[model samples]
Target chain A: MTPEEEAQLKRARRGRNIALALVLIGFVALFYAITIVKMVD
Target chain B: MTASANPALPAEWRDFFALTKPRVMSLVVFTGLCGLLAAPGTIHSVLGFTAVLCIALGAGGAGALNMWWEADIDAQMKRTAKRPLPQGRMKRTDARDFGVALSVASVLLMGIAVNWLAAAVLAGSILYYAVIYTIWLKPRTPQNIVIGGGAGAFPPLIGWVAVTGEITLMPVLLFALIFTWTPPHFWALALFVKSDYAKAGIPMLPVVAGEAATRKQILAYSVVLLVVSLAPWWIGGTGPIYGVAALALSGAFLALAIPVALRRAVEGDAMKPEKRLFSFSVFYLFALFAALVADRLILGQGALS
Candidate 1:
């Protein structure tokens, strides 16, 4: 692959990774949301 | 990826991993854990971990089977064109055999090591995803994701069954929450990947219904998911902590969905909001399930007996 294509691939991989992180964050936060509420109760 | 005859090459390892759909498996396992945590009874430590392991392996097995079956069509989609099967790093028959082995072995392990209820659920999940979703619903209709969504929703129910040895309203509600979430979540991906679906001759909602219809359905489903996510709290399955957090997150999810639903269909950018919703949807399910676990366990709502 050309340098530009490699850069593009890197960018795409980054985006997918970011997307994955967003998924995990949501997952964790959902639990936290419920947990935090319970902590107070 | 260039296939090498070298036994220790890093590239071949990737093929094996890709066949399992690791990202999807992570989500499946997490949800399964949440189900196990939220069930209204005690589970032995060894049995708990074994149930989770079997679920993870079973999910991975089912995913591998999906790739093996869809290898031909996968090469046609940009998002999936480079998968191990399409890239020829893994042979189709090899993947199929591997999937079958894992599927049966996981079920057997779960049955003997954990509870039969959990094992049955796990076995059903594999069949639902590998056969019902992949082979039946996907190609036949635009509502494919709707029906196929059940496969993803099985984790919590299965997890619950792992502990209780039976089905219950609470886990079923959790299952419903994820089932409702899948359509909107996937429709968002479908919006952006419509061209890929179209090119591959797959009939996703965004492709068949057009942007306007897709957006409408997304918003509609989001509204329904928001309501469903909140039901656990209202129905007394979860405490107020879960109720409040689930409601707030559902509101945020809806806020994100509203704009996508209302946005004018821009030519190149029609997919932007859908993409955002897709990104958020992943978070939505994870957060919601986590909250359920947290409230029950950490906050002492009902985590441990």
Candidate 2:
């Protein structure tokens, strides 16, 4: 692949990683809230 | 325009996200949340959130798959030409895989996390939009939106079932309200974008039946929608607040539809009334659902179960 194509791939990968991290964080927060609610109940 | 055939085309995160049709997902999520909130029972907030999340994801997945199947048709129309698949920013196979994965994951998660009934409806809805509507009905008949309305109506019903664990009158009413509301709402849009459908070779109402016939049908559907929208309150399923809001909103809906129905075309822009009614229809659904939740919260136990 050309250098520009390689750079594009890298940028795409970085963006995907950030999106994945945000989703994971959201899941953790949701699960934590569920646990707190379950404990209180 | 030739879709990029390059195997090396790196799909951006935004392109993948666009495949989900996030704008459409927002409405799905909102209606689902409203249904959850309006239901009689209280759920663990986490599970409630999860149910809405699943609804959003399921709707998104279905939308992605619809775009995948309709990519060629979308390419033909100016309105949809800029979509990720049509633009060739993402491969069709990648979109199909992403859609399938999300659909399966959402349904399974819903079943494990919430209840089977909600999950079942979610699965059904995903297939209904992706397969029945997108692949089958849309190209074949002008009645596509009329029947396909059921798919969009599912989120609220699923949300209700997620909380109540069974189908009931109120949720059924919610479903019917949207189902009935859709023909008028979408037909109004078709009136404006008739040329787009013609170019795409999709048999939308205006293209098949002509603009006058489409306008009359819109009026008829709008009338039915108005009556159905008020059913929740009349049946004692919701409180006075919702009843009042439904009355006012449906009044506005009918008022807007009247001009579009009577006038052959607007003087300045033929699409003006159609556009007005179309915009108001979205707000109408949101406001009506919001009122349902508001009534339930404010009236406490006095609100009907």
Worst 10 residues of 2 chain B by lDDT: B1-10
DockQ for the candidates, in order = 0.03, 0.59
Off by over 4 Å in 2: A28-41, B1-7, B266-268, B301-305
In model 2, the clashing pairs are none
Clashing pairs in 1: A26-B283, A26-B287, A27-B286, A27-B287, A30-B287, A30-B288, A30-B291, A31-B290, A31-B291, B296-B303
lDDT tens digits by residue: candidate 1, B189-226? 87776778898888888888888898899899988988
Tens-digit per-residue lDDT, B1-305, candidate 2: 22233445668788888989888888899999989988888787778988899999999899889988999999999989989887778778999999998999899879977899999999999999999999988889999999889998998899989999999898999999999998999999888778898988899988899889988998998899889999999999888999999999999999999999997865557578889999999999999999999998897442122
Chain A only: TM-score per candidate: 0.71, 0.94
For candidate 2, what is the DockQ?
Answer: 0.59
lDDT against the true structure, per candidate, is 0.81, 0.88
lDDT of candidate 1 at residue B134, scale 0 to 100: 96
